[model samples]
Target chain A: MDMLEQYLPFFTKLTPQQQAVLSQNTTRHTAKKGEIVHNGSLDCIGILILVRGQFRVFTLSEEGREITLYRLWERDICLLSASCMLNSIQFDVSVEAKKETEYWKIPASVYRKVMQQAAPMANYTGELLAARFSDVMWLMDQILYKRMDSRLAAFLLEESQLEGGRELKMTHEAIARHLGSAREVVTRMLKYFQSEGLVALSRGSVTISDETGLRKLAEESLR
Target chain B: MDMLEQYLPFFTKLTPQQQAVLSQNTTRHTAKKGEIVHNGSLDCIGILILVRGQFRVFTLSEEGREITLYRLWERDICLLSASCMLNSIQFDVSVEAKKETEYWKIPASVYRKVMQQAAPMANYTGELLAARFSDVMWLMDQILYKRMDSRLAAFLLEESQLEGGRELKMTHEAIARHLGSAREVVTRMLKYFQSEGLVALSRGSVTISDETGLRKLAEESLR
Candidate 1:
C-alpha cells in the first residue's frame, strides 16, 4: 500500500467504487522543515494526515508566546482544522513541519461528499473527532495539574517512544518553547540532568542516558 | 417551541418534521440540587441537554481532589460522557446538578440515527462540538499560565455574564475549586477585592461593584 492508503482510516472498509472516488480527490505533498502546512488565517481546507516525519500544532498567545498544543506524527489526522471547512472559520492553530514530512491533504468538499455516500466513512470521521476530544481533555488535565519539569519529562518520553530512539534532535530552546517555559530555565535543567548523569547534551541535541532516572524525576516533580 | 427545540443540535437538526420525532422519543426529567446525573461508572445511554438551571462537570484526581472541568446551563449539551457511549469506556468525570434543573435525555442510538438521516442536524452537531473544542483549548491556555486569582476573576466574569446580573450564586469554596486553588486563598483574595471596593461578598454569594476593575484585575493577573 502507498503512504496515503496506509495512513487514511476507513480506506479498506470502503467499497472499491468508493475508494476510487477518494483516490481521485486526495493530493499528497512533501513539506520541508519549518514550512507551515496551515496558518491560523488560512481558509479551511481538507484534513491533513501525516504520512511521514513530524509536525507541531500550536497557537500564539496574545502576549506573542507560542504554545505547543499537539505533536502530530505518522497516521495522525489533523481534525482541529477540519471544522473550519464546514463552518468557514479560519484555522485557529498553525501546523508546521518539524522535520521533512509527507502528508496527504484531502479536500473537505470531496470528503463530505464521500461521507454522505459512505456511512462507514462518516462514522470513522466521527470516531476520529471523538478521540481527538478525549486527547484534548487529557492535555488539559496535564496543564492544570502537572508541573513544568514533569511535563517536559513526559514530552521527552513520548517522543522517545514515538521515534524509538534515545537521541533527540531538538534544541533546548525548542523544548522550552514547547513546554511554555523560558529557554534559560530549560538550559539550567539540562545542566542539572547532566550533572546527575541522567542525560547527555551536545550542540542542539540530547540523548537520554538513564530513562529510569528521568521517570523518577518526573514522578517526583509531578508531586 | 419546547426544550427539545433548544437541544436540536444534540440529535439532529429538527425540522418541523424531525422535531416531532424527537418530542416523541425523549423524556424530560427534573434534577434536584446536588443530584448526580451520571457518575463515573454509569453506562452512558443518552445525551443530556440542560433545559433550565445549572450543572457542574468535574472529575476527582487520584489524590481525591475535585477538578472542575465545565459548567453547563440551559441549552448546553453535555459530551464529557461521550466516550462511554462510543467505546463503553468508563466515564472519568461526574455530572451533577448545581441547582434544581430540567433536562431532556435522548438515547444515544436514536441520536445517532437522526444524525445519519439529517444533514442539517449533522452539521449543527459538528459545529457545536467544534466550538467546544475551541473552549477546551482556551481553558488549557488559562490553566497553563493564568494565576489562580486571574482564573477566579475570569470565572466570576463568565458566570456573572451568564446570569445577566451582578449578584453571583457562588461561595468562595466553590470559586476556589473552580479555580483550582485553596479556599483560604480565595477568601483572602475576596477580602482584597472587598477592600478595593470591587466586590461585596456574603455566604454563598458575591456581588460585583466594579465590573471594569475586576476585568482589569483578571487581565493583569493573567499576564
Candidate 2:
C-alpha cells in the first residue's frame, strides 16, 4: 500500500481501480525551507498531504506584511492549494515551507474524481474544509474580541512553549508577521511588558521574566 | 422540478433515484426576525439554503462582543450549521435570522448521503466551502491590514450604500458589533470623522457629509 493511503479516509473502501488511479496521480514532492510551496496566483497546485516538515499558510498585504492564517504539520492535508480547481475562492492565501518539507501531491482533477466516486472521500473533503473554516473563525474571534496586549502575551507564551524554553530567539519583525501586526506595535508592547516586569527583552530575543504575571495577562485570550 | 433542485449543481445529472431522495429529505422552514436559528451546541442541523430574507452568521465572545463572519442573503447556502456532522470544526459559529427568513433544510445524514452519491453535488459543496473560506480570509485581511479609521470609514460608507441614503440609522453599539470593536472605539472614530467634516453624527444616526473624502478613506481598504 502506498504511504499516502494512510491519509485517506477509509482508503480500503475505494475500488481497487480507484485506488490505482489515485496512486498514479499522487507524486512525492519536497521544498527547501522558506520556499513558497503554493502561490496564490498559481492555480491547481492540488491537494498537499504533508509527510514531514511544516507549512505556513498566510495572506500577504500589498505592503508585503503577512498575517499567518494557520500552520500545517506532518500528515496535514492542504486542499487550499487546489482552490481554483474547486470554485469561488476569491481571497489570496499563500503557503510557504517553514522548514525543509516533504509531501505527497494529488492533482485536483484526480482528487475530485476520487472524492466523487467514494462517499468516505467526499465526507473527508468536507471535514477538512469545515476544519479550516473553524480555524479562521477562531482567529477572527481572538483578533476582534481580545485586546492586543492579551493576544501578544498569548503569542509569546505559545512561542515559548513551542521552543520548549522561557527564552525565545525571535526578532520583533518575525513576531509581528505571525501575529499579523506591525513591527513597531509589537516592539512598543514588548517595551510595555518589559517595564511592567512581565517579560525581559534583549536584542532579538524575549525571555519570560515574570512567568506568573505573563500567564495571567495571556489567560484573557486563552479560551 | 423542486425549487431546491435549482440550487444543486448539475441536479439533472443526479440519478433520478438520488434526486427523489434529496427532494424527500429537504423541507422548507422559516424563522422570525432576530431568531436564533442554529446554536453552536446543537449538532446535525444539516445544511441551510436561504430562499428569502437574510441570515447573519457570527461568533459571540464570552464578554458578549459579537463579530460577524458573513451574512447569507437570498439563495445562499450555509454549511456551518452542520459543523458537528462534518467533523473537526472545533470552534463555535452561530446563525440568526437577521430578518424574517424562509429556507430549505436538509438533515445532515441525507445531505451527506446525497453528496456522496453525486459528483456534481460534492463539487458544489466544495465550491461553497471555498467561497466561504475566501470571505473569512478577506475579513481577516481587513481587520489585520487596515487601520480602525479606514475600517470605520468603510463601514459608514457601506451602510449608506446599503440603505440608499447618506443618513444611516444605527446606534454606536450596532456599528461596533458589526465592525468587531468596542462601542467607545466606534464612537471615538465617529467623532473624529465628524470633526474632519467627513460625516455628521446625531442621536442614533450618521450622515456622510463629504462623499469624496469618505470614499478616499474607504478606498484604502476597498481592494
Query: What is the alpha-carbon interface RMSD for each candidate?
Result: 4.1, 2.3
Task: Give per-model TM-scores.
Answer: 0.73, 0.81
Judged by TM-score, which candidate is best? Answer: 2
lDDT of 1 at B199: 89
| B70-140: candidate 1 lDDT, tens digit per residue | 57888888765444544422236788898899988877777767665665555555555556566556555
Question: Any runs in candidate 1 off by more than 4 Å, and if so which?
Answer: A1-22, A88-91, A113-119, A219-223, B1-6, B9-25, B41-45, B88-91, B113-122, B145-223
TM (B chain), model 2: 0.93
Residues A70-144 of candidate 2 have per-residue lDDT tens digits of 788998999788876665878777999988999999998888877766766766787788788777776666566
Q: Which residue runs does candidate 2 get wrong by more than 4 Å?
A: A116-118, A148-223
The per-model DockQ list reads 0.19, 0.61
Q: DockQ score of candidate 1? A: 0.19
- lDDT score at residue A136, model 2, on the 0-100 scale: 75
The 10 consecutive residues of candidate 1 chain B with the worst lDDT sum are: B82-91
Worst 10 residues of 2 chain A by lDDT: A214-223
- Give lDDT per model, in order: 0.71, 0.82
